[model samples]
Target: MVAKQYVPATGDIVWLTFSLQAGRKQAGRRPAIVLSPQSYNEKTGLALFCPITSKVKGYPFKVILPPSSRVTGAILSDHVRNLDWRVRRARFEMKAPRQSVAEVRAKIAVLLGSGMSSG
Candidate 1:
């Protein structure tokens, strides 16, 4: 039997593979938070994600995710990556609390230094 395929959604913790990266970029398979809507994930076969790290550094841009059944670590908001979430590359784990998701998104916005807005 094969592993089940799941479409990722915001707040979801998942294991996904990143292509070889250079200079502080994330590579290899690791846990990441899905920040994209499920509809977008399905349509594009991609999920915008922030890489999680156990190497907690208390950085201003990193958000610490307290221990939870879903995941436990710091999300590297500065090292966000949009990558493949297809079955072959990603496996859904669990969802973080809505508040945590919101916090993460907010940090990313600040990291970007511009409120992403459209008029």
Candidate 2:
């Protein structure tokens, strides 16, 4: 019996084998928050996500995630990337609140460093 594949939404937290070191290395599984829309994820089997880390590096792009049932960490917006489903290890039922998700999006906009227009 094959397990059902779950398409993660914009606020869902999931564990995935993320690429690190300038995309030259694949690291151990870690929690990440989905940043892309579910429609994109469903169509492409890929999504943009920001990593959750325990140690705060004080980066301007990092946003703090509120504690859920299991973990509390900062969303490293600088590390956000589009990842394929093959890298996904597990999905957590835990979802980031709407406010946190909005904060993460704002951080990502800042990280882009282009002063994206709100219009």
Candidate 3:
């Protein structure tokens, strides 16, 4: 039997093995926010996300997120990326509030200097 894949939704946080190391691009399991809409995930089998990290140093580009399932972190909008099951692990330990995700997306748009609305 094939294992089921977790379908991430916009505003949903998920745990994924993202590339953190520079040279070798080592896989680092971390939490990230799903930035793409459901349609994109369904049609392309790909997902867009913004990596979340605990290394917040009052950075202007980072958006501080509320604690989820005892995991406290901030969304690194500057490190936004796209991925598929090759790097995805599972959904977030806990889902974030809808409002929190919206705020994160707004911050990301500002960082990108794009007026594009969130999906």
Candidate 4:
């Protein structure tokens, strides 16, 4: 009998990839930074939103990070910028999968460090 290795629950940790999309004339733009989720719903693949004030609108963008394979920080950031600054939208599909706990943690640390340095 072979024993299967246990995979950590999706709620453990995940990364929300983001991207920025400009006008119709400028499509396929590069993504920005990634957001790290503390936990997520394994079955539903739902991630918590990180609150951030928008520079252009002066309102907060509730970014909903989903469980996907190719979601990057840039993609997530872009989506937030496109929102109306109020109300949540339907869950969208992620181009990538979720990152592991370690990967998420590392990315978060890097983001924090960079943020602190910039500030």
Candidate 5:
């Protein structure tokens, strides 16, 4: 039997390893929000994620997810990262609320100096 490959969907919260030390970078195995769409992940084998930290610092760039999302962490929109699932040990936890994901995307767009209309 062949091992199944992991492909996370947009707004899906997943736990992944972010090992290797880096100054001020989020490390260790923690829950992260998947920002890439399913099609993109399937084609590229890469998943875009905004790492979540349970420590909420009240930064404007961070969006706090409600407990309903099964996570009580602040989504660091400024810390969006893309990693190969095959190496990162990404595992699906739960799909976050669409509103929460939209909030993160809006923050990320602003960080990138782009506008995301709330339509």
Candidate 6:
């Protein structure tokens, strides 16, 4: 008997949670594309860690691609896509009515956690 694997469907929002090998938690979520059944050369995996800001937050995070992970190109390309998406989403969401800069900063801090930089 063969064991079945769970693969995410296209347009599915998946959360990628990470913790440092030494034991610190970092988590983020993004929409994923399922590329397994479509192409022969394409490997199976979900998009994770798509950054939601224009500039890199400088927080240390790692993407846990499975052992079976395979890509035709550089992994950084995937990272770029995730980062772009994150920034766009953040910008769109930050436009709240009558909100001050400080309020925005505080909100971001709360969402990203205390250690994350405001600027």
Best by lDDT: 5
* Residue 3 miss distance in model 6 (angstroms): 3.1
What lDDT does candidate 1 reach at residue 93? 82
Question: Which of the two candidates, 3 or 6, achieves a greater lDDT against the reference?
Answer: 3
TM-score of each: 0.83, 0.79, 0.75, 0.24, 0.87, 0.22
Any runs in candidate 3 off by more than 4 Å, and if so which? 1-5, 20-27, 114-119
Where is model 2 more than 4 Å wrong at Cα?
1-4, 20-26, 113-119
29-119, model 1: which lDDT tens digit per residue? Answer: 8888888899999999988898888787758877788675568888887777777677437777888777778888888778776956676
lDDT of each: 0.80, 0.78, 0.73, 0.30, 0.87, 0.28
Q: Candidate 6 — what's its lDDT?
A: 0.28
- Summarize candidate 6's per-residue lDDT along 41-105 as a digit string, tens digits: 12423222232222233343312233332211111113323222223232111111222223333
Choose 1 or 2, whichever is better by TM-score.
1
TM-score of 6: 0.22
Cα-based lDDT at residue 50, candidate 4: 30
The sequence of per-residue lDDT tens digits that candidate 3 reaches over residues 1-119 is 99966677787777888755677432588788788887888678788887778877787767777654456777777767878834466564666677777777777778777766688
Give a tens-digit lDDT track for model 4, residues 3-118.
84222232322222333335522122222222323232233334333322222332222233343434423222323222211122223332233433334445445555655644
**How do the candidates rank by lDDT, highest first?**
5, 1, 2, 3, 4, 6
In terms of TM-score, which candidate is strongest? 5
Q: What is the lDDT of residue 55 in candidate 6?
A: 28
Model 2 C-alpha lDDT per residue in residues 1-119, reported as the tens digit of each score: 99877888889988887655655433668888898888999899899888788887667777887655465878887777788855565576578878878988887666676866788
After superposing all C-alphas onto the true structure, candidate 4 shows an RMSD in angstroms of 12.5
Better of 2 and 6 by lDDT: 2
